[model samples]
Target: MKKKPTITAQTKQNLIDAFWELYCAKRIEKITIKEITTRAGYNRSTFYEYFTDVYDVLEQMENTLISKLKELPMQQLSSPGDPFPFEALVSMYSHHSKYLVVLLGDHGDPAFQGKVKASMKPMIKEILVSQGAKDGFELDYTLEYALSAMIGILSYWFNQEKGPSIENLMELITELSSEGVMRKLIG
Candidate 1:
C-alpha cells in the first residue's frame, strides 16, 4: 500500500517546521537531528525517512521558496511602461514572512540570500533591459543594487514586529524605486 501524498507532505512539513523553530533561535551548526525529532514529536528514524540530515531540511525549504517564486507572472511585469510589480513582490514577501524573516536574518544561512539573488537576476535583468539598460558593468551593478535593495528592505520590514501594512510597504518601495531615495529624503 502507498501512503497518501497529503500525509507525506504533512509529515515533511512538521519536520521542517520543527527544524525552523530551532533554526530561528540559533545557527544551523548548533541544531541537531535529535532536537528536531524531539521537537517534532517523531522518532530519529522518521526524521531520516524524510531528511538525510538537518541541513537537508533547510535546503528543501529554500528550494521550495525559490520554486514558488519562479511560478509568478514575472514576464508580464517586464512590459514597457508597467511599474515594477510591487504588489506581487510585497504579497510574496508577506506570505512567506515567517520563513524569510529568519532565513534572511542574523541566524540564517548567508548563502541563501545569494541563491535568491541568483534566481531573481535573470528576470530582473530582463526588466532593466526593457527599460533601456545596456549590457555590461552598468547593468550588472544595477541588477546587484536593485536585488540587494529589495532584499534589504524586505529583511528590515519582516524583522519588524509591527512592520508597515502591505499597501504601505508596496507604496514605499514604489516611491523609493521610482523617485530615488535622495529625492524622497530631500523633498
Candidate 2:
C-alpha cells in the first residue's frame, strides 16, 4: 500500500537526521549505512528507498539548504534605499544552524562553501551596486571578500557553545558590512 506523504517525508528526515548525527561526529567515509539505519530505527531496505548511499543523503541535504537560501527575499534588496535584510538573513541561517555549522566546518565539504557563495552572488552584486559600488575588479574582489567573511563569521557563530544572541549577531554583521573591518577595529 502507498504511504502517506507526511510519513514518507518524516521517514526520509529521520534517516537524514540519523546520518547527520553520525556525520557530525566523524568523516563521511567512516559512516556506514548500518550505523545510519540502526540510529534511525529503520531497515536497510528503507534507506535504499530514500537514498542510494551516505553521499546521497549529504547531497540531498545540501540541495535542500541551497534551495532554501535561494528562496530568501533577495529581490527586495535590489530596490534603492532599502536596508539590507539582515534580520531575514540571520533568521534563515539561525533556523538551519544545525546543518550549516557542520556543512561549513572543517570536517564538512569544502566545496559546499563555494556553492553557498555562488547562490548569494546575484544578491550581493545588487546590494553593491545600490550602494554605489562600481562594476569592475574592485567589485569582484569585494564580493569575494564579503562572501568569505560571511561564511567565516557564520561558521564561527554556529560553532560556539554559547554564541551571541541573534540580534547581536545581526548587529555585528551590519557593523562589519557598513564599516570596514579596519575602521571598526580602530574605532
Candidate No. with top lDDT: 2
Tens-digit lDDT string for candidate 2 (1-187): 9999999999999999999999999999999999999999999999999999999999999999999988888767433433345566667888998888889999899989999888887776676576665667766666677678978987898888899987798788877776773232222
TM-score for each prediction?
0.86, 0.83
Candidate 2 similarity to native, TM-score = 0.83
lDDT for 75 in candidate 1 is 68
lDDT of 1: 0.78
The stretch of ten residues in a row with the least summed lDDT in candidate 1 is 178-187
Clashing pairs in 1: none
Cα lDDT of model 1 by residue, 1-187, tens digit: 9899999889889999999999988888999999999999999998998899999999999999988777777867544543355566667878998888888888788898888888887876676566665657766666677678888898998888898986788778777776773232222
Q: RMSD to native for every prediction?
A: 3.8, 3.9
* Reference-based lDDT, each prediction: 0.78, 0.81
Q: Which parts of model 2 are misplaced by more than 4 Å?
A: 77-84, 130-132, 162-165, 181-187
Clashes counted in candidate 1 amount to 0
